[model samples]
Target: MYRFSYSEILEDAPQLARERERMAFDRALHLLRTVEARGERGAERTAAIAFVQDLWNVLLSDLLDPENALPEALRSDLVSIGAWTMGEVGEALRAPERSLAALIEVNTSIRDGLQ
Candidate 1:
């Protein structure tokens, strides 16, 4: 059996949350990159796109929540970044010539920032 102290339980809660977030972003980035390498593989592209969309939607919702602990200005900026990410994803999907590099770059940046 294992035991924990109250102080330990209370500390670094957000670090755990951030680690989860970082992993999700990494997974999403991997999916997107795979789709990019596969070119026109329909199912992979669809899955990757849906994953990115869902991830961003969840993030946006959390940012918008009144109980969210992030600073007001920082949350606002993150919301804007999320909006741009969604926009770029939509645009890339709509245009055959458009590339997913922007999506990859932005996701990488966000994931790195979580450190």
Candidate 2:
């Protein structure tokens, strides 16, 4: 069996942050696409949406933390985006036919910013 450790892969602060954000965005993209195809119905879609919400919840928590190292302005911006994401998740859940472009664009933009 192959075992992977994040601590070993991300030994520096910069690399760690970038890789973490990239992974989070990738997860969001995957879940979003899954829900899109499933039309937001059934347990699978619900679980995917919940997972996406949890990702943003963690982002929001990190941005809100007083000990976070990010600049105030950047943290504020991310918090705002996080709030938008939470709302988007609710909207997407309510309207199964809604476009996931917004969610995908947000994740992609944030992921790119980390690079």
Candidate 3:
């Protein structure tokens, strides 16, 4: 087995960040779709929303941090999007039948922006 060092991974921060964002969105999309299809409304749905919320929290934290390297305008845009996402998640949970198109579109837009 080949092991990658933590430092080595951090060396490619841009690529890693993009990949992570894409993966997070994909996971969120899968979870949302599953819940929408089966109406399970169980642990999986909770976990899915949690995952998305967690992603936004990280983005918000980075945007708020003064030490972060991202430009002010870009950070502001991300924060706005993150806030909107949280609101959408709340609405989705309340009405499981409501379409997830908004959330999906937002995730796709963000993922594409990261590319």
Q: Across residues 13-96, which tens digit of lDDT does each residue of candidate 1 receive? A: 767777878999999999999889878547678789889999999889888877667789999999999999989878876775
Models, CA RMSD each: 5.4, 4.3, 4.1
Regions more than 4 Å wrong, model 3: 1-12
What lDDT tens digits, residue by residue, belong to model 3 across residues 18-102? 6876787788778766766776666777777777888787767767877666778898888899899999988877875667678
Which residue pairs clash within candidate 3?
none
The true-versus-predicted C-alpha distance at residue 54 of model 3, in Å, is 1.4
Number of clashing pairs, model 2? 0
Order the candidate numbers by TM-score, best to worst.
1, 2, 3
TM-score, model 1 to reference = 0.84
Q: Residues 1-115, candidate 2: write the lDDT tens digits.
A: 9854333333456677578778888887888787776666767676777887998887787678776677899999999998998999899788766787798788778878877
Every candidate's lDDT: 0.83, 0.78, 0.75
Name the regions of candidate 2 deviating beyond 4 angstroms: 1-12, 37-40
TM-score of each: 0.84, 0.79, 0.76
- Model 1 misplacement above 4 A: 1-12
